[model samples]
Target: MKKLFSCILCLSLMVCIPVYAQDVDYSDEDYWYATCSKVQTSQEGVKACVGFQNYLDDQFNKLKEEMESYKNDLGSLQLNSSRIEELAKKQKTLSDSLDSQVKNMENQIVEINKEIEAVKVEIEEKQKEIDKWSDQISTRMINEQAGTGTNILIDLIMGSSSLNEMFRRFSGIERITASDQEQIEQLSDLKKELELKKDEQERLSDQIEEQKERIEEEKAFAQELQASYDQLAEEYRKVEADLKQKLQEQAAASNNIPSAGVISPSVEVTVPSVSGFINPVPGAYRSAGTWAYPGGGMHLGEDMAASIGTPVIAPADGVIIYASNPAPTNGGYLGNWTGWPYGGGNTIEMLCNVNGTLYAISFAHLAQEGFGVSAGQVVSQGQYLAAVGNSGNSSGAHCHIEVINLGSMSMETAISRFAASADFAFGAGWNTTATACEAGASAPCRERPERFF
Candidate 1:
């Protein structure tokens, strides 16, 4: 019976030892790596792979969120820059206006001084005439008192030789008195005119001084605004530098992950009615559906598969706001490619207004040195814009187009409307909705090329 008990205990010990050997701490990095490495192409291996992918995806999402934050910061900085430019323009206008006003005031002051001087000279001449008349009257009064204590008119009439001569003498005496009276009245008018002119000059001077003070105030305010803008610009530069540093660090971290290339393509597509817009591409082309990329992010535009050297045209009348050769770098693949950092190669962003609504159209992945128009150039509907080619992160020759509503609609809504329009023109299956979007389960801001073609 003792030997039987011993055999049972030995069997129990063997079972317990195997269970202990099978136990694994999955949270440990070393253990996880070891287990995953040994996994073959089986159910267990697939599960392990999925788990690892999920972990990497989580990290990628975090980094993406950080990058988005930085992008928002950069957008704010751009807005600030625009504000500063607007303020500067306003300041220039104000300065010009003030300068013109100052010049006019100075001219008016000069004219007023000339008028005042003329009035002063006229007043001096009138005073001299008054003194001369007074002296004449005083000498006549003294002669009359010394000769006879009688009226000068009576004396003149009595001294006449005949009746006709007396009448003539009386007329002459009356004319002299009338002349002195006229001179006295003219002097009085001149004094009154001088006082009025001096008052006008004083008022004009006051107005000029007031205008100068206002201009100074306005100039000071403009200087203050400029200083504020400068400070804000400095602060924005510092923030931008910090954000760039953080982005570089996050990019380095993402590079360290091994499963960075495994991404799924699943999204929703829509169809709607066509409107006033026409197609941009005139020839044969295929729409590479939204979210068709394996990078697990919104394409933010529809890719049109076409042969190299295919002519790209403008869908509507618009002005080119941005046209440039993109930098030769692929941010996603970490390789030096001949294109933009975001893999769009040569790019153009145009602004078009339709039915009182502003829209921005972005064209990307054009052939190198194939741009037909430049920035600030206006192109009509169906005008040649560029040529299709495999530039940037393109797998083949294609044109990427993005339609952004510059109105009140959100990015998602604009994309949805664009997708519907494309579907109406090109039939269904042009766009789709997906869970693995930048907004996390929300619709992406990319539509099919048929919407604008």
Candidate 2:
């Protein structure tokens, strides 16, 4: 369970899927290839090259900013011990951002691969042309040194009998000599041009290779940061209440928080209810684990992943305890913590009675202005709640649902308790020891929603 929780926390990195790799015309491979291959050639190609390099520079600059931000985040938390989990989350977010930049660089390498290969072929052809020109020049020089053309000219001049014929022969010989010299000059110029192209190709290819190596190094660094973070923290070390407070603080720091009790328009959708509870997201199949498996991640709730605007409904008969829309539906980004409890965008906290047992259920990352019900509202099983949103700390559109067993706790008691202290997941989620609900345990126990679903 600890390992699973770790994996879940890592998902926080993926929450803000992309801080956009800019979409510019210059990002094309031809432009990237021209950036180097035409260094000594056309002005237009040089411009294109500059644009491509500038694109790369911009991405790298963004990465640098993220790194700086990470440093600042760490510095702020250095004096605080209770906020280690938050610090760890910040570290992971920055690490993921860095890793994402590295991938962008690698993608550039891939995009320019064809162009680079074509340049290599051009270099080889230029070298061949240079070789041919050199061979022609060498032959001409050797002939001149041996007086081969000079003897021909002399023979032609001496063999002429009539003065008119002799003049004609001299004219022909002069013409032939001038033509040979002109050919050599032209070939020499061509050879220099080919050599320039070859040099440019070599230079640019080397630069590209260096860029690739640097990206690999950056990738390694991101991995190292992830490893260090994993050791420093294990998902959530603090209690749910503390974590909730931290999220609230983070939102407050922004100063642009969405006010609570913001009612949304009514939504019409069918919800699938089986016995006491219904699928919160009718068509979306929910993940039933604490965190993502196969690789390390951290997730506290069952995620019902779907496209934006997908209807989110109540899992069972419940009363809305607390509801708020704090962030926009499309406002989610990496490292953003705006929301009621840090990334729990447009949250709806409710305590429901499934059969005879009381359970506290929460829905997070809901669409903006899509709240069909509000605080203290009486909602039935499979009632329209909200829509899936790509809200705070979300990688995509999904509703994160958490269910607490609440043992024998009364619905009224659970609601009042939560109202007093906005502790999510019914008192800090699963225990580090046992996953299943302990038999004869006290009321207000956290239960795995997967079992109920």
Candidate 3:
């Protein structure tokens, strides 16, 4: 029993100490879950945690590579939604993968703990047998064929001081029954098994800790992207509002000429049934601004309010110039324009020909995932483009529609340079600060929907 205990101690010591790698593994699962960065929590007495910057950087880069692959697949800046779906999938995978792997690790840990306890109990029962037949186990071990000399037990016989002592030791070996020898061998097996369980537990615990860090960092970078996206949206809202004010002035010169206290709609009483251009939001009514707001804010687009899922169709045959579909349909506030094209939210812009001239028709505050068309896709007049949503700096559910006539630019050149810069204003001179779109200005002027729709 003393020898058995000695061997077990040696095995435990081997598990407890290693020559290299000062890192330690978790003994409890809570230790891994409760902490994200031990290095960051150094002053609070935490250890075995990951380094904040290096570990996070590695994970951030890996996920960025995965997201960038989707972006590259999309092939153009007009397809800003390319990375959003991939980011969502990656986030979901991170969650599911961590849950499954951690559950597996937990099950392994529980079984290993049970294994360790069982081994301890087995050793205890063996120790009890030693107490039951103390005299027999106290006798020296021996090799049945001393001449074969396989085991260290022969040392006892060879190291005897005298002929009488050697025979006496042989007699001692006779008292060591087969049962006692079997118990020693069983204990040896138990020691090896225990060491393996310990090592495996240590390894699994380390993997779980590393996995926790990786997942945490990935989520951190995603949140960082959200913050940056929101900040950019806020900044662009200022510019969008400013440019819109300037565009409003272009039409204000003609519009300011006459208005009773009540601004009247001049929509043609004779609605054409089989015309080239049609009303984009067919079932919706103007809720607020039309050409210009009632109080005359720089309303560049007409606001057509409708139910949340109201379909907004293309007014004429057109090619989709740009589209973004990342924001939530009902997640808009007064100043929240958080997506591509800055403050436009989930927007879609198409280049169409109306009245023998190219027109860039923009539909803003569109539904997020509810859009049926993608950027660069072609559609006929009255085709389903997207559903209306209260996104961006909007207060209610509606679609803000803007139309700019592109003079004589070819379809290829016009589509290529639609959103060339922040000052794009849908097309070329639509909002050029110097170009006044007063009553009779050229083709690049803002066209009124009430006058033509």
Candidate 4:
């Protein structure tokens, strides 16, 4: 019986040992078993529970940190239109990585469930042992002649051959009861530990589930971006084409020379006292006639051909409508300062009214300092706006003067008219918008049927 009890105790301890990587011990019973523990169910249960709990803690912290980093990256990506493709690619990679991690966590959870089942079986065996011992105690009580402490004393008196034998019987019953009590205490501790572990496992399971859902959400978002990428590329292509076309037309118009004797009625009338505004550049080589006349391409406006320090002059009394460096490849007379194929390196536009018609007179190919005029300042004709420099499509130092009507024409139309009209000196000096340029006066004035392209 002594050997049998010892074997039972050893087997119980062994039951809780972990099959996984670590050991778990939530109570004194677990430590006690570990000390006397054999390879059995109770020992394995304790170890597995502790191991699973540790795994849960480690994984939860790792995933939480990763989620925070991903959110921050996404926030930055949202602000930049140029980084859209790169952002999508990175998001996809993160989603895939998260999926793999979630799978690993879930597999760990499955192992935890199996460990719990093994613990349950061990607990059931312990309960059976408690019941068997309880029955043995009940039988000993009933079979004995004594029923109470007084009855036990009288029975000992009648049955004893000597006082020592009576005392020994009493001591044996005490020992049995003590052993039962110890077993009950140990079983109770194990049961409490098992309940705690089960709760922890449930909590971790829920977290893993939530993470899986989040991974799925991110994956869906990545797919959505992939689906839209092609469409965005096509739209970008269209925008690029439109911008290139406008730039080319602008360049051509700036270089054109108008045809003579082909006067359009729209530009026929000249404003009074216009001659006062014609300030010539000093040392400029003047063409004898308007650009329309033969051999007259010798620079429409004063080609100051000035050095970097030469002061730029505003051609008329006007408010500064635009005063800044030109964008790269903006092209044409306005875009000259920026240099080109597409020109208009650094430039400015000033709005002046002649006989109630608004005109935007622009200057290009200016020194850097010249591009910094205050918009809306009233500038006198020939007042310094900036310095001249060799900064544009020109072969040498020069400034390009171009006139425009700010009458709500689309930029493309304005460019076309300016180019086509440059051939006829003063042909670009229209009182109306470019849309009305070739319309020849009609209701709801339409563009000329001919398309420049």
Q: Which candidate leads the pack in lDDT?
A: 2
TM-score of each: 0.31, 0.50, 0.40, 0.29
Q: Predictions ranked by lDDT, top down?
A: 2, 3, 1, 4
Q: For candidate 1, what is the lDDT? A: 0.48
Q: After superposition, how far is residue 188 of candidate 2 from its true place, in Å?
A: 5.3
Residue 64 shift from truth in candidate 2, angstroms? 9.6
Of 1 and 2, the candidate ranking higher by TM-score: 2
- Score each candidate by Cα lDDT: 0.48, 0.60, 0.55, 0.45
Which residue pairs in candidate 3 collide?
none
Residue 196 lDDT in candidate 2? 50
- Give one digit per residue, the lDDT tens place, for model 1 in 365-392: 7776566886546678778998776565
User: Which stretches of model 4 miss by more than 4 angstroms?
Assistant: 1-58, 78-93, 105-126, 141-453
In Å, residue 319's CA in model 3 sits off its true spot by 0.3
The predicted structure with the larger TM-score, 2 or 4, is: 2
Q: Which portions of model 2 show Cα errors greater than 4 Å?
A: 1-97, 124-193, 231-236, 243-273, 276-336, 346-361, 365-399, 404-447
65: Cα error in model 3, Å: 46
Clash count for candidate 1 is: 7
Error of 2 at 204 (Å): 4.5
